[model samples]
Each structure stands twice: as C-alpha cells, then as structure tokens.
Target: MRCPFCGNLETQVKDSRPSEDGAAIRRRRSCQECNGRFTTFERVQLRELMIVKRSGRRTPFDRTKLERSIAIATRKRPVDQEQVDRMVSGIVRELESMGETDIQSEVVGELVMKALRSLDVVAYVRYASVYRDFRETSDFAKFLGDEGLSDNEDT
Candidate 1:
C-alpha cells in the first residue's frame, strides 16, 4: 500500500480484520519510510456502476451520498444506524446484481422508497418528499392519502 504521509510505496500491514458489518476489510498499516500509521478499508466492487440522470447526464454511483441522504431522512427518528446501513447494503447489492452497469437515477430512488417504507413510515414520507420534489402541503396530504395513511390535524 502507498503511504499517504510520505508518498512512500512501501507499507506494512500491522493488523487486518473484517469490519463490523462484514461488508469490508479494515487494515492497519505503517509507512516504511515515515513510520506513520493509518487505517484503510477494502470493499468488493462487483463493477463500476453509473447513474443516468434525468438531464441526459451520467455520474458515477456514490454509496456515501446515498447513505447520507437516507441518514438525513431518518434523522431524529426511532430508526437506528444499523437498520439504515442494512438498507444501504441491500440497495447496493440489488443494483450490482442487476447485470447492468448503467442504471437510471429514478430506479435507485424507488428502491430507497421501498426499503424505507417497511422500516418506518415517517422516514419513508420524509424521503419521498425530497425524492418526489414535493412543493406544497397538499403534496404531502395527497401522498399520505394515496398511501392509506391518515393525517390527524389537531385543530
């Protein structure tokens, strides 16, 4: 491994173990030249996935961005971090196993909506508002009605 501190190409792995989620391998290393220590994670990439945006543009799939958005939607909710991670991992695995590197951005959004729907209704609604670009209160009302959820207005 290349050492980030001194740009040295030689580094020795002092310890290695599977990550908490078992989705990646974490390795602790020391630079041979600078003796600096650092940690790195290795994840298996089935292929380089590309997202075809609605604007006729293409961008590389970013897992962290997806996770961040989901986290934001679920923030302050009763949902835990582990459940969020599992949803992210499941979505990634589903996309990878589709056998096509190019996927529509809408497809990804729908996947998140479906995953969040079963996890928490509030989180699902939160994600849907952003993903569907809700612009008014009626938008939320209609969505809730369509989903068979009641809106209790404390008048």
Candidate 2:
C-alpha cells in the first residue's frame, strides 16, 4: 500500500482484523520509509450497482456520497460516526441483496429517510427538507403531520 503521509511506495501491515460489522477488513499499516501509520479497509464488491436518477440518468452507486449526505443531516447532532457507518452499510447490503443491478435514486432517498428517522428526529427533518424539497414552512408542517409529529415538538 502507498503511504498517504509521505507518498512512500512501500508500507507494512502491522495488524489486521475484521470490522465490527464484519463487512470489511481493517488493516493497520506503517510506511516503510517514513514510519507513518494509517488504517485501511477492504470490502468485497458483489457487483457494479447503478443509480437511476429522477432525470432518467444512470450513474454508478457511490457509498461516499451517501455517507456525506447522511453526515450533513446528522451534523451537530448526538449521532456518532459508527452509527452513520452502520446505516450506510445496512443500506448497501439491502440494495445488493435485492438482486438488482440498477436501483432508483428515490429508493435510496427513502431508505436514508427511514434510517435517519429512527436515528434522530432532527436529522430526519433536516434530510427530509432537502430530499422532499421543502419550499416553505407548510411543507415542513405537512411532513411533520404526516409523520405523526407536531410542529411544536421540542427540539
């Protein structure tokens, strides 16, 4: 592996173990030239999954992009990084197990909303605002009502 710190070509693996979810292998490595340490993860790619956007455009599924969106929703909240990772992994697993190479972007958005809803209400609302494209306060009011929540609920 290439050392990220010094751009060294050679690196030595000091330790290896399965991640908490058992979906990836975590490896601790040190750069041979600089002695800088870093961690890496290895995951199995079952197949190429494509995301079909609302515009009818097809693009490859990106886990990082999903993570970023979730992070933004959970920002400044009590949610932790591990929970976000688990949510992303769970969604990917669900998508892969469906036995479909192409999935709708709407499906992904709904899954995220579901996950965030259970994790944190604030994060859920934050994500829903963007995903549902709320243009005004009534949009949020309607969503809250539909979800059995009152707009006066304590934040």
Candidate 3:
C-alpha cells in the first residue's frame, strides 16, 4: 500500500494481527522513503445493502453514519473506540446475514439503540433521544422508565 503521509509506493509491514473482533486484520506499515508509520485494516467487503428511509426513499448503506452516531452516544463514557468499531461491525454483519437488500431505517436505528443500550445506559439514552426524536420531558422520562432501561440513577 502507498504511504499516506509521503505518497511513497514502497512500504514494509512492521506488524500484522487480526483485529480484536476478528472481522479484519490490522497491519502496521512503515514507508521506506520517509519512515512514516501508519495502520491499515483489511476486511471482507460484503454485498451492498440499501436503507429504506422513513420518507420511503432508499439509499445505499452508509458506514460513517453508523460510526458517527455510535461515537456521539459513547462520548465521555468508559467505552473505548475498539468497542465501538466492533459494535458497528457486528450490526453490519447481522444486517447482511439477513440477506435483505433493503432494510427499514427503523430497523437500523433499533440495532444501534440495542447495541448502545448494552454498552452504557447513558449512551443508550443519548442515542435513543436523537434516534427516537424525544421532544418533551415526558418522552425522555418514559425512556428512562422503560422496563428494559437500566435503573441506575447515574444514567
């Protein structure tokens, strides 16, 4: 692979290991020209999946969107970036395994919420607030009081 920093085509792999989740392999490389080091991920690319939005519009699945949402929800939490990455990968794998080209947006949202809920309640609530569009205090309260919600006061 070309070096990202120096645009050098020649690079040496310093290390290679499977990612924690085993979905991809992470390679540490050093540019022969500039000695710059960087990491790259090699993963299996699955078939494209389309998301059916609430407005009845279909769009290609966007991984960045899922990552961004998870990042926002996990902000300031004990969760680490690797955990977030694994969660996103798991969700994508689950969706693809269903063999559905078009998945409802609600399904995607629920997947995120479910993953976040297990990671951290505060994160779960933060994600749910935006995904579910909680406008009123009651809406927030109901979510907090939901049966599946953690009863921890800190959340």
Ranking by TM-score: 2, 3, 1
| Better-scoring candidate (TM-score), 1 or 3 | 3
Q: Listing every candidate in turn, what is its Cα RMSD in Å to the true structure after a full C-alpha superposition?
A: 3.2, 1.5, 2.3
**Candidate with maximal TM-score:** 2
Point out the higher-scoring one by TM-score: 2 or 3. Answer: 2
In the range 1-155, model 2's lDDT, one tens digit per residue, is 88999999899999999998888999999999989999999988888999999999999999999999999999999999999999999999999998999999999999999999999999999999999999999999999999987858774
Q: State TM-scores per candidate.
A: 0.83, 0.93, 0.85
Residue 54 error, candidate 1, Å:
0.8
| Model 1 misplacement above 4 A | 1-11, 30-38, 152-155
What's the CA error at residue 141 for candidate 3, in Å?
A: 1.3
**118-145, model 3: which lDDT tens digit per residue?**
8888898889899889999899888878
The C-alpha lDDT values of all candidates are 0.93, 0.94, 0.90
Candidate 2: lDDT of 103? 99
- With candidate 1 superimposed using the best TM-score fit, by how many Å does residue 3's alpha carbon deviate from the native? 5.9
